[model samples]
Structure formats: structure tokens, C-alpha cells
Target chain A: MRGDLPAPSAAQIDIVEVGPRDGLQNESRVWPTEDKISLIGEAIAYGAKRIEVASFVNPRRVPQMADAEAVVAGCANAPGVTRIGLALNLRGAERALATGIEQVGAVAVASDAFGIRNQGQDRAESVGIAAGIVEMARRSGRSAQVTIAVAFGCPFEGAVDRALVIDIARALAAAQPVEIALADTIGIAGPGEVAALVAEVRTAVAPLPVRVHFHDTRNTANANIWAAVQAGASVADASLGGLGGCPFAAQAPGTAAGNIATEDMIYMLHRSGIGTGIDESRLYRAGRWLDRKLKGSSRSKVLVALPPGS
Target chain B: MRGDLPAPSAAQIDIVEVGPRDGLQNESRVWPTEDKISLIGEAIAYGAKRIEVASFVNPRRVPQMADAEAVVAGCANAPGVTRIGLALNLRGAERALATGIEQVGAVAVASDAFGIRNQGQDRAESVGIAAGIVEMARRSGRSAQVTIAVAFGCPFEGAVDRALVIDIARALAAAQPVEIALADTIGIAGPGEVAALVAEVRTAVAPLPVRVHFHDTRNTANANIWAAVQAGASVADASLGGLGGCPFAAQAPGTAAGNIATEDMIYMLHRSGIGTGIDESRLYRAGRWLDRKLKGSSRSKVLVALPPGS
Candidate 1:
């Protein structure tokens, strides 16, 4: 029985570096635009093919993203990298398009309560807006994608309906976005839920790739990501030093566990014989640099376990 | 494709609470024998069926386990709960058997380097000693189990060979222990590796169950545990508050990441529709109590994310 088991094939996994946008948005202190540019550059040098560099939201609402355009302009000279700008509305989409970023990411909420609280729209309305953003990006010859936030569970509504997520994915697929993503906004998903949902959504939107974003709030992010990949999700979103949280989401006091750390993710992937084109050493270095810039230790265990210069 | 995917059936998973033995052994400060008894009683209250209450090792080497007999005596009257004692060598095994504990856990090392360093025995010597301990337990009419430490990776030798692990498992199976466990002694393993190894080992040791033990050194413990279960591992070892580290293993400076927290493990297992016979609310309460006693916060993300009272 042991001899009959076949070895798992090594497959390339695409990692979307979201350290600059999703990572910094929740920090208490605002990072300088120059540091944001440097982080983006480090991500590119570490072989991140696609990076979410900035979010074109209202400056007053998200002060950390106020220098979005400056950060975009700073990375305009990078070669062989697709720069993605996240947009929550038409105005944000237009702003991202005007900046000539390579890709535009649209947001759709899976729960009505979170949808209304997060962006003043219901579930259907959020999906419609996200589809419209995809259409706008398509017309402008830019790649576009949609991420269904809180698709697994919602803080206000508890468990979101799985059928609702399928409907949202099918609706977003009509606009022909590059891919559809499921975001565990509050990080309350387990591996089984992730695998089942990713498989269902992958079938719901055939020919379109599936991406996954997870928070490490409950320490299930890495397991959820691994399950998604096993269930046919091709793209995964991660942050440097595991630095990310949703400022709009209701969180426990002093308990803001961020997104899965890129270094830790890469270490697991590479050790498991999966091919991720990112450099683990560079990720550790970038995490250390971010730690110095942020004036705090990184939450990444791999970064903390390995030596500073190793 | 998604429609054809079957819903995974819920299964009962056995959780072996090792808080008293593995959790406190690596702590610099020695906990009182009374506190150790309290911890054991709390584990029983939380529905832990089998608990490793103490290690019959040298007091000079591991001062935390100095009062192993006293601790065992404290929990001797607990009904329906199997109190396990970990023994490293013949002397330790004799001591554990004399204490009248319910189970004796013998540890064998997968790598020669770790075996020599951890127990002053090489690979063959460790296996012989563990097998001898199993015989001793059988003659003494007590249940025994064997754990192959560093089965995944070693701090000194690095990646351990899968074939060597299978051979060790098969050799240990000849001793007729209750079960065999694969321990990531240095906390270095990925989900993919865990799934493949567990499947192969389960086959190699047919009729005997496979248990898994992981440390959260690189933050992959939860993922690894999930994968092991998917691959047919029936039992898992976890510590309260994620408190464990090998005092003999080569570790990075100030980087002694412990085992997966029992609360986090229970949350993931229960959320994934698997039953562990453990109460989640009681786990959080016990974790809070442990935190107060240890004078530190728990490493469990769920414990940290949820409120203390909840």
C-alpha cells in the first residue's frame, strides 16, 4: 500500500504580494510614501509577479492609503511586474485607471450587513458595483479581478450562505474579470470549509482562475490557503511579516492578527515540493526591513526563527 | 466539478493533552507540583481522554519534571481518563511503571544525531530501547505507545528520510504498542509532506493507528495537523497555551516556538466538522488560567482573539 502511493507533482503556485496595500492600511501609524515604494520594490525583487501596491479609497477614510497616487508613480518604472490597485467604488476605479496601473481589483461583499457597513451597499449592490468596475477596467484594457470579502463567515451575520457566495462569483464572472477571489475577511474559516467553497466556486466560474485571501486572526490562514490550493485555487494573497487587518471589521480589543506571512507561506510551499517563484531568503530580509521600518517585530514565525542575516 | 465533490464526513479525533509533560518541560521556570496537578485536573475537566501527566526523566536534566511521582499521585483517582507518563530510557520506564500511571509513552528518534543528542543513544539504540520499554510495559500489564520524534525534520541532520521513518514504524509495530506517533520534534514540516508521510506510514503499520505531533515553530503546525488527519491520522498531540520546546534541540536565539495550542486545534477540528470530545469554552477558560499561572498570554490565536470571559 505504501509503495502504490504516487508522489505529488510539483506545481507552481502564484502568490499575490499584498503587503503594500492591505498590509499597511491597518497600521496605527502612517508609513511614508518612500517606504511604501521601497516595500514594493523589495516585493518585485523577491520575484512577486503580481502586487497590490495601493488602494484608491478616500483619503479621509483611509489615511494610510492617502498617498496612493504617489506610491503608484514611484513604482511606474518597475519592469516585468503587474501592479494592482484596489478600488471600492467607481470613483476609486477611475482614479486607479487614471494612474495607468496594470491591474484593477474590485471588492464585493458576501454578507449584506458587512456590505452595507463596509461600503454603504447591500450584497447585490456590492456585486453590481464590482462587476461595473470590472467592465470599466476591461474597456480601459487593464486586467481586473473581484474579491468577495467575508465569503466564509461574517461578524455581524455569523455564517454567510454558501449559495450567496456562488451567486456572487457567477455574477462577477459575467463581467469577465481576470479571476474571482474569496476573502476570509474576519479569518473565521477552516480548511474543510475553504476546500469545499473553493471547489464549488471554481466550478461556478469555469475558465476563470480562483484566488484566496486569508487572515491569521484565528491561526487558520495557512491551513485554509493550503486547502484552497488543493481544491484548485491558483492564486493566494499574502503580506510581508503578516501585517494586515481590516480596520472596518469588528475586531476583539488588542487582537488584530494579520494576514498570513509571505515568508512563512513560502517556506511551507517550498518544503512541500510546491513551486513558488518567490525567494524565501529575500522574504525574510524584507520582513526584517519592514520590522525596522515599522519599529516592531514581525509576526512571521519563520522570520523570527531564522537569524537576522541568515 | 464542484457538484460532484462529496461533503466530507465528520469523524471523531482523539486529542492527547501533553500540557503537563511536554508543555512545561522547556520552561525556564519550574512550575510547582501542585500547579502541575491542577493542570492535569483541568485537562480532565476539559474532556481530555488521555493526558501525559509527567515525564519520568532525571531531575538534574529536566528540573521541571522533578516531581513526576507526586504529580502522578495527584491524578491517580481520576476516572475514565488515561494518565500517561513519558519515559526516555529503561530507568525512566521503570520509574513510570512503578508510579502506576495508566500509559507509558516511549520515544524513538528518526535520526541518529538527534537520538544521540536527545537521549544519549543512536538511532538503532533508541529503537531497541523504545521496543524494550514496550515489552516492559506489556509484561507489567499497562498500555504502551511509541513516538518517533524528529520524524519530519531534525535540527542537526535537517530533512529526515521517509524510508527511514517507515522502517522505524514497522520495527516499532513489532513490539505491539497501542499506536505509533510521528513527531515534528523540531517543528519543521509542511502539509504536503505530512499528508504523504502519514498515508505511507499508516499503510506500513496496518491495524495500528497513526498519531501526529507538531510544534508551531514555523507556524505550520495547524496546517500540518489538518493534513495528517486528511491522510488518516487518528490522534494528535497538543499542549495547552502552545507551551512546548525541546531543551536538547539546537534552537535559534530566543526562538523556542511550542506545540500547537489545544484551543486552536480544537477550534479547527470542530469547525471542520470533526469531533474531539473536548469543550471549546472550557478550553479557553483553562487557557486563561494557564496564562495567569504562567504569567504570559497564550500562543493560541483563538484564545488571544476571543475575550477571556467568553
Candidate 2:
């Protein structure tokens, strides 16, 4: 250790690998259902405990992930893995609950335009659905997490008021859900904003754990992860090969860019002496393999810059 | 601005534009030298007062910068643009100083193997060259700005101790340079580390304004930039199109993946209401056009996501 360098924090950082859900959802060349299962299995094998396995959405809309059932079933028996699913609507929630997945995710955007474009609903309607979904998850004896998308700034509405996000977060927290995640859906957050928002949410949620979901869309996810953690965010979300942008979320209407690369995030955390429990070598390989399959080169600098193994 | 938002800082954030030097250096296709001048013209027009125009390294070493002298000469007459040059050795510094550039950047690396592979010298030898270059710059009545590359972590040496980086920064600061930039040459810094190191360096060099140079290699550059600013980094180095990593700087060489995109940085800052004086529209245009010309694509989320004339 360097003289007077920062000592490692006593906090145990939890990295919720969103590659299976976020990464796969954004991939143009969809992997077969079995391959998706294998990917999640691989991640769990590499020390990822909490993984977003699949999203329960309209099959016609996202043809790539029509087999949400299979992905969930594939990971149900995986050792020490918490399989999660995304439920955008009541039908999605009902379907996800039917799978008996312990954790389900309900999502909404902070901006009206983004919420409309992303979920075909207004902010109030999305909140209503979040409340209903929380109730459903509870009735089913499962826990659901609410992720507020575009919590930082929105492309359509510009800068979103942090108060709006916090207000909605308070509402969702009142529902007493298991977790809440603040997302930079379009990658518009700065480190200061990340710190401030996480701190605010931590206070609002009190003892309830808060999470951060970031995109490398502007290539700042890793730093934001740290900022959120510093502000007491318990967990962070990342996509493999930095994948997972809402096809409807306009980063560039025609561009193919998305979330923060898992390998890059893992590298920063591991090198900083934070306990992420991830193997950098395996993570890099997964990113490379995923990108190659999609005919998209990874945008993660660490994954691309390092050799096959760190 | 939200009512809950805190009053913005009056900090005079400085942007050290490297499009002319770092951006043009690793371009895949030739830029006819004059094209670079046009680019520089656009940046200065967009209020970039501190522009690094060219490098005085051997033409054979970096063929893209073969016309360093002509490029500097052309940009030298631009109003309010402080043209600088990247100098590798005393010869480069002598040549750069002869051209009337205000600042000559001398680089040293923290890691031994990277220092040798990157600039053909070890840390001590590079320090010696840096000292000599500083002497030459001071003798010519110009300012010397030394950049310690691979300060965060080097590709060859792996994990770089913060102490080595601090020692190099202290030694360079002792030489009375106008500024010292800490380069995360391989882009592996976390937000916590970025903030901690910047805070530490602020103490290491009491009054000198510290700067940071980051690579978006792992999509953490923006986060690191935010952390740097919050931790007291006054200036940041950026390039358009997310271009400019030395072929030897990383384990996965020749990826052309380094530096946070200037447009991305400005977008994040502007969203946070920090004034960079850079027109986001112009920055995006330059990034897109540069990518088109180089047969390369930008890794900037803002550049890729935002509309033209935005």
C-alpha cells in the first residue's frame, strides 16, 4: 500500500450483475434461451450472487427475450443465486410471480416523456402500477424492487428535478419494497449528482438499502458507482459489455450504445481493494464473447485494453 | 434549477483541450494537417482558451503528427488560444519552445515497465528529462506543465501504488511548473480513489491547481472526472471522438480507446450547471465529424445520442 493511501472501507459492496437482463435485452443479436442461462450460470460461477435473470415483457415487443420463463427456470436451481425479473405492467408482474421468482423489478422513468415512451404510461400511472406490483409481489410472498429510470436527467425533458425522484422514491419506499434503484437510463449523471442523489435517497429511505443503475453511455458509470457507494448506496447495477439501453430511450435514436461494462466496473472495484468478489479475467472474457456474438465491439476500455487475462 | 439544489460553486473550472495534440495524434486516417487547424479553430471559437495544439515528438515515431511545426504555427496566431505542445525529450521541448508555444508538457510514468515501454525511459530517467524540459521552458520564459502518465495503474506494472504517483507529482511540482496532470493512462480508477487521490494531491501541492487526464477505457472517465472536480481538480484533459491511446499504453494494444469524450464531459457538467464554456452542439459535431474522417466511431454517449445542432 502507498504511504497514507485510502484504507479500504468496512462496507461490503454488493454488485448486482444486470448483464443477463440488461445486457441481453439490449443486444441486437439475441442469444438463445439456453445461452442466456449459460451466461447467468457463468456469472454466478464467477462470484455474482444477485443477478437479474430475465425481464417479463410483451414477447411480441422484445422478441429477443420471449423465453423469460426458460431463463428463470434455468437459474432457479443455480447455487446461491437470486434470480430476478423485470415487470413493467400488471400482466408482466403476474407472469413473473407465476414463475415463483423471489425478486421482481418494477420500473418507471422520472420524466413524463421518458415514462410515456418507455412504458406507455404517465408518471402517476407508473407509480400506481409500482404500488400494485409491490402488493402483488407481497401477496405472492416475494419481494419486488423499484428502479426509477432517468432519475438524473432526461433527454426529452432535460434535467429532471431530484425532488421528483425523491418524492416518488418515498412513495415507493412507503410501499415497503425490498430495494430501490436510481438509474441514469441515458447516462446523464455526473459524479456530484450521483453522490448527492444517493445521499438524499439514503436519508429518504433510511434503513432500506438503495441501489444505483448506471450506463457507460457517456462512459462514467464506474465513477458514479463509487459516488453512489460513498453516499451510502448499498448496491450498484452494471451490464456486461456495457449493454442494456431501452431501445426507446433516446441516447442517439439510431446508435447502439448502452450500460456500463461489468468487467470495467469489477476492475475498478477490485483494484481499489473493494470486495466485489468478481474474477476480472472471467468477466473480461464474458464481455468479449458477448460483444463478438453481437458483432458489436465492447466500449469498455479496461476490457478492450487488457489482454485475454489481467 | 430545482429549489432543493444547492447554490453552484464559483470555481473557475479549466478545460485543457487536447484535440489538437492527443486527438489528432492517433487518428486512423490522415487529416491533411490543415484539417487539424480547422478543428482547432472551431474549439477556440467555442471558447476553449487552453488548447494543446501539437506534439514535438519525432515525426517517424508518430506519423499522424508529422506536421507538428506547421500545425502549431497555424494555431499560434489564433486569438486567446494558448497553444501548447507535447514534448517527449529535451529535443522535443527545444523544438516546441522555439515555436513560441506557451506551455510544453513533459510526461513521466509511475511504473518502471510502462515508463520504459511508453517513452523509452524508466521513471527516474523520465523525471530527469522532465526536469530538463522544465528548465528549457522556464529559460524560454514559458510555463512547463508536466503530466505523470499511468499514475493510477500501468498496463505493464498492473497496480500502481498511490505513493509512487504522489512522489512523482511532488517532484514535478517542486520544479515550479504551471500545472501538473495526473493521467489514469489505463482508465482503472474508481470514484472513491479518484476523490481520495485528488484530495491528497491538493495537499501535496498546496497552491498549484491540479489537473486530471482520464481515459474512458472502462467507462469510468466521466465518473472519475466528477470525482476529480469534487476533490479539487481544476483542469481536465479531453479529446473529441474519444480518440488517442498510445499503442503501447495498454495490454490490448491499438484499440484507440482512451480519454473521456469532451462532449460527454461538457454535457454532464452542463447538466450539473457547471460552466465549461464549451458549446455542446459544436463539441458533438466535431466528435462525429472526426470519427467520420478517421473511419472510427466515437464512444461518447452524448455525441452518439444527441441530435445535430443540439
Candidate 3:
């Protein structure tokens, strides 16, 4: 039971696979575009309906995602999949829309410190950028989603103000995006913080579906996800094999920053009786394939735990 | 809030350190007794009031714990530390008491299948053995704690009945041990299961303190701990570096069975505004030391996230 709030909006949650976009973007390895397409196809085969397949950022800024157009063009027409592309500006959004992707994900950081460092803009400027992208997507007849990065905490600015985040959500919601996702970019959040923030954001953006992107840096991502679900989040983001992290957040020493492993989250959600409509065995197979391609950098324990026969 | 139960009993929790005993027992490396003692000493230095330092099982069964006597002799007298030793039978209990350890941890399997496989006894026989150990500890004027293994689920028997676990708790509580710990031996439990079962068991054994021992085999241990805490569990068990599982449980392919990492749990609890009274930096230091000694098998993310200077 979610604390003093309505139960989760949906019994069946849509787990958006973010490995192709978020997971591979932070890796040191620049995977071949075919390999990236194969990974996205594998996720689709394993029952990923909503997938963030690529980021249309500058090729020099993020060389790993340089093939965003190619990747989207390759995987945009997968059967029964809603292909998503990340966009930080109108140009990126137009590029993504040109590829026939279904959804464009625009992002704005909560703090000016992070916004300037990450996107060369202040908080207000980044929000304006995201709003323009959302408007463009809507005018072009494509759906859009906005994510608030470091909604819980930030490395550049340390503790982010909740009131500031709520205000940002309110502004982002004003543009009427299809969904608003709150990202714990540094993986420092616990359940209480997630619950309180999601409740406030849900109220601020009435009727707009809220999602969460959690990092397992401190091993609290699963708990944070449960709390977010309890707080009425309908969609959750994860990376296959626990791959991915923000490049800016990787400067810290010994950081185990990664998205929650898709298979691991599926294990917990399935066991808890929450429906994700994702196939666990197929997901595991995808993870095994990813692990081999990534040369065992995957931090997912479930991939190693469920050996072939049992 | 715990579903249909009283609020948690305490604002602060006493986390029981179990790295030296449970963590080492599953490892192939037979650590030197001095290293074991130093680890225990480090836990004490880090404000662990209660620690499971050693086990007095047969050397032939668990060669890793063969230095139990030496480990106890070295760390049992640490000031203000309640040193605990695991005892599977009356003989082990007597050996633990002889070393002047403050408490003996006696365990009983909730399922007959697990009982026979793990201890070569049926459920009733294992309970009988545990009861004898508890009674002996009581007579010797030393405190005893009873752990119900596989209280949530069993690998061999599959899903364990909550009624059966409630019955086992009733039986163990009847022996009047100081604390009754319910262990998620196979790590299949989710927060909902944990909250529901803990609520039932807390009712079954009123006034007998309930502690939870969680395994992160499925990446749900942190959430399970939060559920257990909400259900009025005041004491939680964890290993220092996420380093231990049942030797018997390790035979299965992909059995990523290890106790919740103490540092990770502390990070969650502390960040949630719950007090553990343990020094975080010291805990990280000990983890780093253990990671170097154990050849870096420690599964703790916090150790890697928080570098020496950070």
C-alpha cells in the first residue's frame, strides 16, 4: 500500500528499456552501430514495448551515441515497440522525428550548476530548451517526454531543493508532455525521498504520467523503485545488464553508477506480483548476450545467478 | 507504514554484523585467524554493538570456520561488543559458551526438505536441536538467539507456507530466546512478502524481538529490509562486504546468494533519516581492507562510490 496516496495507477507497469540509449552512452567502448541495433532488437524480442533507443546529441559530445540516427532508422519499425530517442534541443527533436521514432525524450536538469555543466545552459535555459523541443514534437505530431535529471540530489550542487524540483516539474508539465520522468542521476536517493518527491510531482503535474529513472550507485535503486511505484509512478526506466551511467557522474572514484538491471528489476517486480509483461528468461538471454559483448562489465548479479539450467 | 501493524518499535536500529562468520563460511579462502580477528576488531571500532564473529560447527563440515575458537578468544573481550557465535547443535553451543562469547545463534530450518538437506534432519529434529542449544545457553547464563532459516522460502521445497513459518516462530519463541531472526535463506522474498510475513510472525511471537537476515540473491534485500523495519523489526543482520551465503545454497548454478551488505544497508537507513550510530567512513575503511584481503569479491557499491578522499 502506498502511504496515504492512491494505489499505483496501473497494475501493469511499462518498464522502458534504456540500455541502448542511456546504458551505452556512458560506456568507454564505442559499440558498432550493428551491435547497437542487435542489442535493441534483443530487447524488443524479450518483450520491451517502450525503449529509449538512442540520443540525438552532438557526435563530438557523445561519440558513443554518434549513430543515433542510424540506430533509430534501424530499430524504429520493430513490431509492437515504441521507439524513443533522447533530444536536448529542437534540432535533436527534429532529427529524432525524421527517423520515424514514436517518442522524443527531452531532459532538463533541476539545478543551474548541473544544467550549465551538463548542457551549457542554466536551469531556466534548459527548461526553455526542453519546452521548445516538446512543442516541436507536438507540432510535428509526435509524442514527447521530459526528464528532470538529479531530481533527488546533484553532484555539482550537492542537495537539490525539493521546491525547486517541484517547480521544474510544474513548468515541464505545462508543456503537456506525454510523460515526465524524475532521474536520480547520481544514484544517491532512498525510498522516502523518492516517495515524497514523486507524490509532490504527481500532484503538481496532475494527469501526466510520472516515471522514474533510478541509478543503483548505492544499491538502493530497487527500494527506490518500489517506493516510486508506491507513490503512483506508472513507468520505470532500467538498463539491461545494469549498464549505463551519466558521463558527468562518472568522475567520482570507484563509482558503481548504473541503471537498475532490467532482469533484476523484472525478478523483483514479477515476484512482488507487479506485471511488467516482460519475459524473464528471454531478458536473461539478452543480458547474457550483452555481457559477452561488453566483456563482462555488467554489474547485474541476476545474470550470473541464474545459470542456464536453473 | 507497515500494512496492518504497529509502527516500528525503535527510531534507531541495531545492525548485527555477520561478515566474519556467515560471510567467511561460504568463501573458498580460509582466512587466517588473525585476519578474522582484525575484521571483527574493525567492526567493533566502527560502532557495531553486536557482531557474529565465529561459528563452532565441525571443521570437516565447514573448514573455513575451523578457527572459530581462535577468533573468539581474540575478539570476545572487546569492550562494549556483544560477540556472537553460530551454533548448530548443543556441542557447538557449549564450545561457544566456553569461549566467553555473549550470545549463541542457534538455527532451525522451517521446511523439512531444507532441514534434511542442510542439517541432515527433518524440521522437527532441527527445531529440537535448536531448542536444546537455546536451553543449554540459558542454563549457562548466556543469551541465545534462534534463527529460522528459509522462513520466507526454501530452494529445495519451493515456496514455504507463511503458516508453517508462523508455526516455527511460535515454537522458537516458546524456547524463550532473546531474539528470533527470520532468514530469507534463498533470497526469493519481496517487500510485500516480507511485510506480510513479518507482520504475521511479529504477532505470533509478541514481545520477542524479531530480527531479519536477508540475502540479496535477487536484488530485493534492501526493499525487504525496509518492509521488515516497517513491520517492527528492530535488529537487522548484514555482512560487512556483501560477502557470505550458505555453503549448501551455493551449489546451485547462479545462486547469487549473499547477505545484504552492511555498508549498503547503513547507507539506505542513514539517508532515510534513520539512525544506525555507526561511523560510515570507518565502515568503508574496513570494507576496503576486506576487499583487498578477499581479493575484491566484496559486492558493496558504497565502497567503490565513496573513495578515500571523498
Query: Which TM-score values does chain B get in all models?
Result: 0.94, 0.92, 0.93
True contacts kept of each: 0.55, 0.52, 0.45
Give all TM-scores, in the order shown. Answer: 0.96, 0.91, 0.94
Interface RMSD of each candidate, angstroms, one decimal = 5.4, 3.5, 6.9
The number of clashing residue pairs in each candidate reads 0, 5, 2
- Model 1 lDDT tens row, B185-303: 77778888899999999999989999999988888999999899989999999999887663223255222357889998899888888889998888888888898886765677887
The DockQ ranking, best first, is: 1, 2, 3
What residue pairs are clashing in model 3? A254-B304, A305-B254
Per-residue C-alpha lDDT of model 3 across residues A1-310, encoded as one tens digit per residue: 2221122334678899999988888787898999999999999989999899999989999899999888888775877788889998788888898888988999998888878777787899999999889888888888888999988887877788888888999998989898888999889887767877888899999899899999888889999888788778989999999888632344562232678999888887777767899988889889889989978766676776674554
Candidate ranking under TM-score, highest first, comes to 1, 3, 2
Cα lDDT for residue B185, candidate 1: 78
For DockQ, the strongest prediction is: 1
Best by TM-score: 1
Expressed as tens digits, the lDDT of each residue in B178-240 for candidate 3 is 878899887777776777778778989999989999988878889889878867888999999
A1-310 per-residue lDDT for model 2 (tens digits): 4334466442467888888887878777678988898788778777787889998998888887899998888776566667789999999999999895878899866878878878888888898898789889988898888898888877778878888889989888888787788998777676667878898988998888998888766555666787777678888887776666542345363222467777877777766567777776777777777767656666566666665444
Per-residue CA lDDT of model 1 for A152-209, tens digit only, reads 8877888888888999999999999989999998888888889899999999999999
